[model samples]
Target: MKTLVNTLMMRVIEYFASKDMSQITHTLCVHEYTRLIALREGYKTRKVLLLELAALLHDIGCPRSKELYGNCLPVNQERIGAEIVSEWMPAYGKLAPKEIDWLVKVVGTHHQLPMAKEYGFEALFEADLIVNLMEGYYPKEKAALYEKNMVRTASGKALFELFFHHGKMDIKSD
Candidate 1:
């Protein structure tokens, strides 16, 4: 199951595999941060799996958007990337339809702020927060302004506070 998931996600990101090494590295860090935050928060294994998808494909549409729109805004990329992910993920046979529903939404709108206080969406949001904070793209995207706006589960909130207080993105210096 894990291999299947990785295979599907790799194919999705392969769309941008040649564009920028930084893009790939940035994504890997996001994924790692997602796992750390999820485990640190004590999220269920299944939920952590969903968050993994969110991080891996978070910027998957950037290359396509650069070709068509000359810009790779997070919102647009996530929208298109979700469309692509929809093609392969449903066949994986792990998550229920409802889980898939939340997973799809999480991937699609990961860039934008939460529109509702929903669990899946908040999970993706908080995970992205950790990534942005680590990547030093926090305040630039106005994400730093949201560090205090915690949501999601108790574990998630704790992890968010850890990152929030650290203020540094917890990434490597060199």
Candidate 2:
């Protein structure tokens, strides 16, 4: 079952392979990081699967935005990506409509409008932040601020501290 889930997710990701190679790699990185963070935080099978899928498709609109506007604007990508996910989910993952909607919401809002206390959201947000940090896509100076303000889950906070803050601060599990 797990293999089936993962394979389908990978196929969905590869569906856009011709768009932008870097974006695909970025999604893959986010997917792996999301998986790691979710496991570390003791997320169960269903939640982990959802988070991973969200991570994989979080920026699915990047290529479209780049092609249209020559840049990846967050708002544009979010809107476009949600539409893309809506069409792809049913065909690729066999996800129910509600689950597909949930995935779309998480992927669309991950950048600017995340609500508090949501484990899947926090995991995907933190995973993308960590990858963006390492890839130099985002400014390092702002990571500390975002970590302080945005990260909610213990594992997410711990990973942020370890990567951006060098593990100087002690991490406690909730």
TM-scores of all predicted structures: 0.72, 0.86
The clash count of every prediction, one per candidate, is: 1, 0
Model 2's number of clashes is 0
lDDT of 1 at 162: 59
| Residue 15 C-alpha lDDT in model 1 | 53
Minimal lDDT window, size 10, model 2: 112-121
Clash list (residue pairs), candidate 2: none
- Cα lDDT tens digits, model 1, 60-86, are 767777777888787677777777667
Candidate 2 residue 144 Cα shift, in angstroms, is: 1.7
38-103: candidate 2 lDDT, tens digit per residue: 888888888888887788788988888888888888888988888888877887655678888888
Error of 1 at 97 (Å): 3.9
Pairs in clash, predicted candidate 1: 134-169
Error of 1 at 94 (Å): 4.7
lDDT for every model?
Answer: 0.65, 0.78
